[model samples]
Target: MLSFNIYLYCGGNISMKMAFRPTDGWRWYFDREYDSLMLEVSSDMLFRSCYPSKMLIPDVFSEFSFSVSDAASYYQFHNCCHSLNLTESQKIQLSINGIVAANFLKPQMPKSWYFSQQSTEYTPKVADIVKVYMQEDGLEVCMMVVEVGEHASLCIIAQPTFFSMNKTFYFSEAIKVMNDRLALAQQFAQPDNSIVLDDEELELKAIS
Candidate 1:
């Protein structure tokens, strides 16, 4: 059961108000709030960003929520089940409600590629944003490892789409939030429809 609702992440408590103003005509955005990542769109369901991909990281990307991989790392994630031995953290999918920094989860793959302790494949391109996977664990089931107020090296995590935090909140603080949001997102997702916010789709290649 894969859960994907990020709004539900922080305890399924944080509520999002619908301030969307889809107006008539207004074929293009008149302006945007750079500081808050607020956007204005037109009649199109597909709104393209004027900002380059390089300019979006940690800010706009955090708001929109996306990660991608090149050929090498793509293979690495797919082959991880066979080739590499990962630390405990790398083995699970995390819903972060905190901060992040340079080399977020460094010495590991880039933040764009999420590593699942289970055999989850990395998508092949940055254009594929909506990925569907099943969450093996129900949103209600999660094992807690760290305690609240305890400080550990911040692990790099990518929230689907909302905001990218600077790596501040504690692990214990995030547990209930992530689980609840996962259930709500139902794709982080729920057992039948896990929703991973990746930029690419899985293209499996026969390993050598």
Candidate 2:
């Protein structure tokens, strides 16, 4: 399992610390100035940072609640996951409510001129929208990802609802609300930067 630390800052001061383990997904941590958040997945692990707010961590993981004061912190955790190169299984587990859909289109490869080989190799590119949902403490969290080519954008919408009101609120109403929230989140979302891992570090971590 991979393990790493996530640090979030507010007004230039550390606001929160998050611990992420491949086996446990992400957890809240309070330690100060620990080791870097990097772990080996296959041959190496990569780290990079972008507009943190673009990836909403709180919505993806149920362990943390969304709050205005610590909003950036949540993004920081999401950035850490990107840096750590989380696996598909890890991501699905983090979506505690279970993934609604994860559809992807296969990217076609160009044919090589050297040989008469049919380009049978294709990479699965995640679709523009990837959604996950979870219900907790009288609220429902919806996490969605909008991908453009190789770039991915994230959004999280939390809505308040009660089991008692289920009869009163139409399912379509809930979907509309979720859709509205998603549109709003998209306005502030940005594309993520690519982070390449170091094979040497990955080997060391794997052995350690």
Candidate 3:
């Protein structure tokens, strides 16, 4: 489930409106009175400021909401997944309602590709977005530790070979490698589908 907060500006005053969404989508509304913007982003999203700053903090990347103060002060935002360990043949499927920023969760290889303690059980909130994975065959599948909130992390493995392309048999090879890594993980994903956004009240509408 993704949520949005609209910013309306008139003269020198700014007002924000909270909009609930039922699904993963994006929308923006602007008029003479003010300009409104809505984005369905995930917890991994990051917010960047166009204003020049020397701070080395990178930027405040968290799951929250804020408003723009000045028209001259713009922002640059993007979606990213941190701690994602990938190979040359592997690719991350990304989609966002707003923006995202991610970094390595570990200091070294293999173990460094785990999610934080606050991202695993993360339920689909108003700002929650969706993400999918794609990988070639023969690639070893590893388990990812997702930290949902303030508590423990959920360890999960990639699903089995449901999709394949060409005669390369990439999907089969990938599954074989994954089975070698952890046979139990393969079993875990067999019954579970990809992460889903569960919001009944928010409806996805076409944006013009």
Candidate 4:
């Protein structure tokens, strides 16, 4: 199978938006270019269908790769089909981009797994994937692949590490943070209402 990576583009200070419900945050949207698949994120995430003007290919994965900035000093390099088989809910979490997904399939995943409903046949490897996050003790946060989907599909394994009981205000909070950090590039003759791109070129919309 052939795998390609495409970045979503938008202008101005780029920020990520997440779609959310009051109870649970994160909405998933499917982008046909990357795959007919959408990962999960908070509601308030922002970005338009076209914003990023540049796409950079990194050296970590044989597949396509792109770098995106985050609220803090963290950076995320997204790779596609890095692995062949990943179970449902086994999402690759990008703290920088504020997105999580399991682009592959694994038999060990549960049937009630939420991500399995729309799961594809692509699994990404951690070694090939490059993710940068802040560390006080230098403990590498093990990448977790869970069955958690838009709506808590199966029993969610709540841990103290990443999962939080507090409603993190998925997209809104992230967008606010991103906008404050990035500088808007000079505006062209384009319209004012156009959405901006995130660290990756994907449209900033996180409305599932």
lDDT of 2 by residue, 5-55 (tens): 121222322111334333323232211123221211112222211112222
TM-score of 4: 0.21
- Candidate 1 lDDT trough over 10 residues, lowest sum: 176-185
**Top-scoring candidate (lDDT):** 2
What pairs collide in candidate 2? none
Writing each residue's lDDT as its tens digit, candidate 3 over 1-208 gives 1122111122332111232222222222212121212222323221121111121123322222333311111121111222233211111211111122111122112321212122233332211112222333333333332222222222223222232223221111111111112221211222232222222212122222
Between candidates 2 and 4, the one scoring higher on lDDT is 2
List the global CA lDDT of all models: 0.22, 0.23, 0.22, 0.23
Where's the lowest-lDDT run of ten residues in candidate 2? 96-105
Using Cα atoms with residue i matched to residue i, what is each candidate's TM-score against the true structure?
A: 0.20, 0.18, 0.18, 0.21
How good is model 3 by TM-score?
0.18
Model 4 misplaced regions, further than 4 Å = 1-9, 15-26, 39-141, 145-208
Q: Which order, best to worst by TM-score?
A: 4, 1, 2, 3
Error of 1 at 53 (Å): 12
Error of 1 at 145 (Å): 28
**Candidate that beats the other on TM-score, 3 or 4, i.e. the better one:** 4
